[model samples]
Target chain A: MGKTYALTGNPNSGKTTIFNELTGATQYVGNWSGVTVEKKEGTIKNSDIQVVDLPGIYSMSSNSLDEVIALNYITKDKPDGIINVVSASNLQRNLYLTLQLLEMKVPVTLILNMMDEVKRRKINIDHLKLAQILSLRIIPTGADDRKELKNIKDTLTLDEVSNFNRFSYFSEDVQKAINELAQKLRETEHRLENDIHWLALKILEHDREIIERIKIINLGAVELGYKLRDEIQKQTKMELPEILAKQRYDYLREISEQVIEDLDKSLVTETVTDKIDKVLTHRILAIPLFLTIMLMVYYVTITGLGDKTIAFMEWLVGDVITKTVIAGLNTVGASEMVVSLVVDGIIGGVGAVVVFVPQIMILFFFIAILEDSGYMARIAFVMDKIFKKFGLSGKSVIPMLVGSGCSVPGIMATRTLENERDRKLTIILTPFISCGAKLPVYLLFAAAFFPSNSHIIVFSLYLLGILVAILSGVILSKLRYRGEDSDFILELPPYRIPRLKNVAIRMWDKAKDFLSKAGTVIFAASVILWFAQSFDFSFSRVVEPSDSMLASFGKLIAPVFSPLGFGDWITSVAFITGFAAKEIVISTLSVLHGVSEGALVTSLQNIYSPLSAYSFMAFILLASPCFAAISVMKRELNSWRETGFAVLYQTSVAYLISMLIYQVGSLII
Target chain B: MTIVDLKPGQSGQILELNLSTKIKNKLLELGLTPGASVMFVRTAPLGDPINIKVRGFNLGIRREIAQGITLK
Candidate 1:
């Protein structure tokens, strides 16, 4: 059996980097908070020891969700040992969390990371003395270095374990008070006798949640906790929690002064981050620079190497594979209906969306680079000044940015928001940011309607999405979510060169997810839609598609959308199928019109004028997200009523916007 | 004066904390205790969230919360 250990640390302390190096797992590592909301486990390479990467936390106070998660895992799962990863670059703050872990009495090995950065600042740590003082084995290693991984593995292999002398951080009077409370706690029916010290400390601090838990153990524990809290407050002339925190800080400072040495000018040099931020976060240049970078990403994906790769896939799936499959079926005496179903319906429908995978991959690649290199935090920081004016928290920037890739995880990311109003407002406005699933719809229309200026048109669509989101956020915040704005506390991590391997892993993961969806949901939806389009109400095959069941159903809803200008049964059916998944909009059109890969624009031109086509694209861009995203929204919001409201609002807004654009464009054109 | 009053490239010692219990606890957890020397780094481009260096790390916080930190 493999021994299990939990790896824990402060946010951006290089915990995930060490986990990746030790386990060879390609987990996503970003340079900000809320990156790892869930605990992930992997087996160590060449050993049976399993390492669990707990979410980064500041302390074991259990105030936030991430801290609660880490604390609960330590107390409940009770891993065999803990690898306490601390940052050498910021030892004072990082050591506070390490001390808390030590107070839990869990066996811990300290891994001092970012030693390279520390050294560059002319700071030196006496690791031997520090380890002796803390009574733990300490190893200094850079996050990207592999040499110390073997040392960690070897340390985990040790069999003998002994309790170290517990350091008392509190004053003698406070210790006396804790001892009395601890003794009372032990005499009661409390099941936490083993953690009496921790319980007594929590009681003194009046940690509300901990007090409640202690009440279950023994009602007397609650009364005793209140008494201790009042007594501590009187004695210290400060809040109980603050008093305890200050004591720990004093202890940490004492150890830090003895064990760490820094040159006189360690804090005075113009660091690399300072030089870079002066320009990147400049007052006059930040917004325009951000826009230019985003424009370049879209331009390259649509017109550069991404386009070339997509063109090759188009030939392989649309022409070569389709032709060969139909010929083989004909030689084997397959019926014409079977050939049509296999070649035109199944292959043609799914192939049209599959060929665009290269472009999607390229887009995600750039997004991954931005996130990994720490620029995503800067974007949030820069946009917060604008987001605040609209009554949304700056934290909303994270969910919207993630929403660009997909809405499920994006909606889930709202867990980081402390205010309920901010979380809900963010959830409602998140889907307004054009997700990758909506890309195919925009590209299809851009190619058909705006050929030479496709890049700019698509870029404008993105800007329009942002505009709609801001307007809706403002309206909603005024009507329902009005209050004092939630505070934004963010960390701007030093930017690093994005690791190529990490970027490739992220891009591949996203592309593989898209391709897998194309094979499964898109394939099944295409076949079912083809059947519905091919059969009439009498259950007989129809010569004209207008006489089929799908057409009859589309005719029912087509008039409802006639005001938006694309009211044909075919386009209506495409919109209906699109609710299942966004990419199905393109596939449904190909199946309904019998158009192959390259002939879609010409076929669409017969049904829609360029002005109406743009309107249709606008509708698709703003409409309700796919069913999967809605289900996730329901789960995250935990309210069907709110989910229903979101979908209704989205579709209504899409309709109004599309109608306005089409009506005005028709007159002008 | 409060942290929000500090200009760019200035430093001060935190003298008092007068915020809600929740925000105060979070700041303490991040090593922003009273008497810690804090330097005002720079505001973001649009000048709402201000950066400060304390305990050898930079923290970016909005002006609303920064107003809670009284400094000398």
Candidate 2:
């Protein structure tokens, strides 16, 4: 088998940057089969060995999903060696994770990244001295600098051996206990000496997985661990794990003192970050700043540049593609039925969804910038206080923000939250946030019927989502388990100039995901919709049907929405199609109404009045997210029950809100 | 005194924890053991969940929990 190596580190450690540089064009990025967690694997440019870039995590303790994924891969997959990437500037805390990995006895080569950052901060690290003390080869590298790849590649050739011995910073009594356990492991008949010792230490640390594994190997190991724990507690008067952790930190501090030199005490970047945070995280300024930024983003994407791009694409599809296809069908002497199905159903339906790609890309562009520049983290920090009042953490803000991009990623991002209750609540409420996919539907209706006040209408729809999400969270917290008290702990990565390459890559990745879905799920749905609309159950001849199946279904459900003002069968069917993907709603409308050549604005006005249009926007904003989002929620929450609850809750909220809007508006108008 | 009483930039060593049993357990899980040195990072304008640097990471603790953590 070819040798495998893994890149593991804490968040914001430039681990991904290093991987991208090493693998270059060889990398493949996709989801981890059924899970929403991203899986990245690639081979070294000039080597046969494959490298897997695990998710960024603080430690291998499995407190969070990233940790679980990282730890599971390292321990179970048993890579030939592991590259323990550490940020040289943040050596003290980074070393904590390194020490944990060392205890696992994996053949680890330390890659000290961000050497340039350390130099800029006036910190000097004696790499040779550090390597000697840790008993591992260390390579100091600046991930952004291509020159450091050669040094990293050279160190990768080192023998897969761990020479380090475990050191405990605990009291002498606890150390004696560990030493005894270590001696027992050495004396065992097991051929794997390193694995045995590592397993024993993990047992001492109360690692559930290790304990379970030991039970399967030898029940006697459990008795030995119990005795060790009892003896250590009796002698040290402290918890076994805490004692070990303290001891490790003590040793780390000593090593840090010797090998690290700090020439400057002031962290200039931190000062700047804090100054920015003061305004960004300020209670009064925060919401307004957030609103203003979002407004600018929406204006640029939905009404400004993005709208223009989308309009052009729509024109190309509706005017050019549809006309060409129709002309071809006519020249071939094709039946009118086949021509309408080909031109109106397939082309029009798919065209509606594809036209919204520009808006989605522009929205993701701003989101990527916000996330990469570390402003998204601050948004969480500032919003945490408000979310806390509703029994949620600051981290919950990420899901909500992501929901604005697409509920699928928003629901997936909930994995970062540690609290199960918080995760569930966040997932369920995420659909309330107006996703980018829903923008076309909103813009379509808003621009047509509520032209002059379209901006305000769109803004209100987004605001309504926030209100509903918060209200649902509050209600759920009060009703559900009251035991989980939410708390927030987040690392504030020092703000740097957003790298254009990284931003572009992120934007491209997100846009690619949208396009891939459009090509597959939306494309298939469009074709199927075309087939359904073309054929009908008639007498004997099987001639062209008067009304398609979709039209019939729309008529069936249209009455239920009559209270909401736009009870038109075509409009109802459009809403139903949105369940597949929000952009498909517009496509369905265009196909159903036979408006083969018109802007979404013009097409929407033919179907909805001003009051009904506003109500439709409200409904789409709060409706159950696309099928992909529901599936993601199922995966992240790991419970069909929770996913079902999310869909049910969203649909109910959408119904109630839309009803209220339609009723109130009709009475006033 | 509890962390809630500490001004911004004030540093202190944790002396005692007076939180409810459940909250205490949660705090312990997050590596906030007694005797850890902490520095006040900042407070929100409304003064809830005061930010503090502890155990080499930033943590935001609510006023209720902050009231429980006595600092020396």
Candidate 3:
């Protein structure tokens, strides 16, 4: 059997960069068995040594989702070895995770990354001495060097029978308690296959996951465990976690004193990071700088270059593909029904959603740069104060920003939020942001009704989307998700130049995901929509769509929207087709009205006044996201019931707000 | 004094964490132990969640979490 090695490290330790380099084209990404934490695993290039890239974690304490995923994979899967990545610049704190990996009895090869930064800061680390002290192979590597990359691959294949006997960092009293409990645990069904001492320490530290697991597997062990825990805390005058962490740091401090020069002195005395942060995260300049950056991002993605790319994609998919396919079908003597199905149902429906790819890509491109350069963390740092007021964390800003371009990737980005409630809340709130597709709907209505102040009306609709999201966040935090601690403790990683390759790779992944969804959910929706619009009650193809089954269905649902004032069958059909894609709302109306997009404004002018038009725009802004977004919601929420709840919440909120806008305006105006 | 009690640029040694066991375990793991010195870097723009330097790294810790950590 090929040897399996688990790649583990502290977050922001360049673990991902190392994994990408080592695996190259051999890696594939998938969701972990139960959770949304992404699992990346692959064979080392040119070798059969399998590497499972466990989620980046500070410590294997199972205190966080990442920690639990790493701990479970290591303990249950029982990988042969661990490739623990530690940044050299922050050696002591990074080594904290390294020590935890050692205690698991897995032989760990330490990759001391960012050696150049250490050298630049004039902080000297005796890698040879450090390796000897810990009894692990340490490869100190700089970012620019490829020499150590090969060194890492070579060490992974080696049989590491490491004697990490220095792993015993606990005091005598704590060690005695652990030894007693570990011995007792061996006899119970709580017999961990390996590292029972580590398990003992965890239970003593009040690791709820392990302790709860022990309670079911070995009930009698709980009594002894609690008794020992109480004794240790009383004897040591320290909580178990405190004791464990303190002892580990003490040992790390000791090792650093001997192996690292001037370990007590601050290694970073106003480094480049601090210098940049002074302006970027300054007391007065920070928020303004952040706002300017966000504006630039929005301008580039939504209104500027991003808009041109999107228009190009629309032209490519709409006119080019549609015309080419029609000519091909005509030459083949295909029937009119087949031509309509392929052109209108297939190209028009799926193409409508696919056209947003450029905007999504451009948005993700900037997002990737922010993430890769580490500025994204500072964004959360700057925005946390305001976002916390609404029961959301600062990290929620990224999803909303991404949601403005498209909600699919926006919902996916919620995976970064570690708290379950925060992730769910962000997912529920994100679709309320006016995505680019919804913008066309707003502009069309705005132009048709309030021709002069269309820009302001469109802008108000955008603000309304944000206002509704914030209000919903407040409501949900109180009622749906209360008592769950929305804790925010984010590490501010040192900024680095964003790698173009990494940014491109991120865009590629998002693009691939979007295209796949367009092919599946949106593809199916269009075919069904075509059947609805094409056939009559007896399944006879009709010349006019108003005479077909869709009109009857739209007429039935039209009155349900009467309170919002756009209850006509034409508006109803547009919204129905909009379930597939929002941009299709304009096309559906244009098709049903027998006019092109330019004349669509004059056509809808009589149907809606300024107030009802604004109300109609309000409904589309906050209503249920398109079918493609719903599929993404299903995947991200990982449950149909929660996705259903999210859809219901969005649509109901949309209905109430639209009704309020229309009713209150009619009364006041 | 808790971490929130410290002004910007003020430094203190961690006395104890009064948070729940789970949160305390997390803070401890992040190197806010009894003896570790913490430097309150600055508060965020809207003045609630503060940035602090601990163990040679910066953490954007929520004000609520900071209020639970006793500093000396």
Please provide TM-scores computed only on chain A for all of the candidate models, following their numbering.
0.91, 0.92, 0.90
Clashing pairs in 1: none
Who is ahead in lDDT, 1 or 3? 3
> How does model 2 fare in lDDT?
0.74
Docking class of 2: acceptable
lDDT of 2 by residue, A25-105 (tens): 787786654355778888888887788998887666655677777777887777878888898866766777888888787
Which stretches in model 2 have alpha-carbon errors above 4 Å?
A31-36, A168-172, A179-194, A263-271, A282-287, A319-339, A538-546, A597-603, B15-36, B54-61, B64-70
Best by TM-score: 1
- Considering the true interface contacts (CA pairs under 8 Å between chains A and B), give the fraction that model 3 also has: 0.83
Off by over 4 Å in 3: A1-3, A159-161, A188-191, A405-424, A436-458, A478-486, A573-613, A626-645, A665-669, B4-7
Q: Would you list the rank order by lDDT, best first?
A: 3, 1, 2
The first chain of model 1 has a TM-score of 0.91
lDDT of 3 by residue, A1-669 (tens): 789899998878888888877787787887776665557888887888899999788888766656788888888778888998899888888999988877777789988898888888888989999999888898878778758777566787775857877447778888888788888788863455666777787778777778877787666666788998888778777777788898898888788888888875754366688778888888899989988997788667756785587678768876788789999999999998998888777776677667777777787898888878889888888888778889998989878877887787788778668778888899999999998778767756776787787667877887899999999999999999897867687899888887676677778877877787678766776677778888989999988988889889889999998999888888988887788777677657755564545566888987888888888899889999998789888877879999999999999999999999999999999
lDDT of 2 at B30: 45
RMSD of 2: 3.3
Clash-forming residue pairs, model 3? none
Question: DockQ score of candidate 1?
Answer: 0.72
Number of residue pairs clashing in candidate 3, backbone atoms closer than 3 angstroms, sequence gap of 3 or more or interchain: 0
